[model samples]
Target: MGDKTDPNTTKIIHPVYIVANIQNKVRILDGKKVTYSSWVKLFKLHACGYKVLSHIDGTTPPAKTDEDYESWSEIDAIVLQWIYGTLSDDLLTRVLEPDSIAYEAWTRIQNIFLNNKGSRAADLEHEFNNLTLRAMPSLEDYC
Candidate 1:
């Protein structure tokens, strides 16, 4: 075969695909913006397509001594990297925990955005103002 290969057939290449697809398709999830839901959905679909959804969805991992645990841990780390890479530095610092796994980090992020409706509302209002300002000639026309 040529240099081309199917990502699923090779574990080594799967991560490359995951990172590229995620970084390219998903925008950086800055807490200041109102893109969290769309970002989550896009990342989840890619993770599921690459068969690593368990890394972020609270799936139980095997014991440290288990043979499968080694591979599982490696994949989990990769998934964590994907999440962190797409996050803004401030938010990453807020959610980063000592020795935390992908699932824990994911849950913390979900809670931060989901429970904080005030922040979301503020962002939506900012977005609405910005959109109208750019789209219309003046405030009266926008209203």
Candidate 2:
């Protein structure tokens, strides 16, 4: 995304960060020079349904057949949801008692898979299982 400028209107700015991977490792680009506001915006946008892709040395991602990018995108979305949802739930649970309305809302969101109980539930569960298998300590650990 490129920066845009307008003279007449007030602007809501989003902080941009270059996310890159190197030598099979992922890291934020120019991390030290990033401002706190930018950092917060970067994270907020990421939390709010933005997709961030990783690049190495400005090159296209390592190649795979059609199977790779599609799977990566789905996993990326699930991982992002898990990170943001977990943190939000933790904060809500700590600040509001379990019986509080806010806590109930959080609980409901977390249990959305169960409440929906349809193809969506099956899809999420399948993705979760695949992710769990991939994240296992070893190939023999889980299958």
Candidate 3:
């Protein structure tokens, strides 16, 4: 028999798929003009595609040598690109600087969104309190 490979049985290249389908699909956020509602929607969009975004999280295991620097640099560039690419120019100026780390940038955006208080928060709380399951549905739909 001639040597042949089955394309159907070949392993899928996940990184390519992640880059194309998940990473590229992330919408750029207008951080400067974002309202609470828009911020929440953008946050959910990012959360839904976090697997692609996780490359930017830089969670490699701790090491004692200088060998990891190259890898770390690559991760840092990816994370920084995502951070800068997603923010509006006005907000980008506020959140990032030459010395800022990726984690800090990510955390800053999250804190800005999460620290909401006042009328909007109260209104959302009221709606959440009144929410009920009306009919049979899948768990995702119920949620």
Backbone clash pairs for candidate 2 read none
lDDT of 3 by residue, 1-143 (tens): 99999868966443423443323554566744556456546644664354334433445433536786656556555556666776777767777877665666776776666675576579889988876777527667669
lDDT of each residue in 63-87, candidate 2, tens digit only: 4565576554444444333333334
Candidate 2 shows a clash count of 0
lDDT, candidates in the order shown: 0.81, 0.40, 0.58
Tell me how candidate 1 scores on lDDT.
Answer: 0.81
Off by over 4 Å in 1: 1-21, 32-34, 118-143
Tally clashes: model 1: 0
The numbered model that scores best in lDDT is: 1
Q: Which candidate is the best by TM-score?
A: 1
TM-scores across all candidates? 0.71, 0.19, 0.49
Candidate 2 wrong stretches, greater than 4 Å: 1-67, 89-143
On residues 66-94, what C-alpha lDDT tens digit does candidate 1 reach at each position? 99897888888878888888899988998
The pairs that clash in candidate 3 are: none
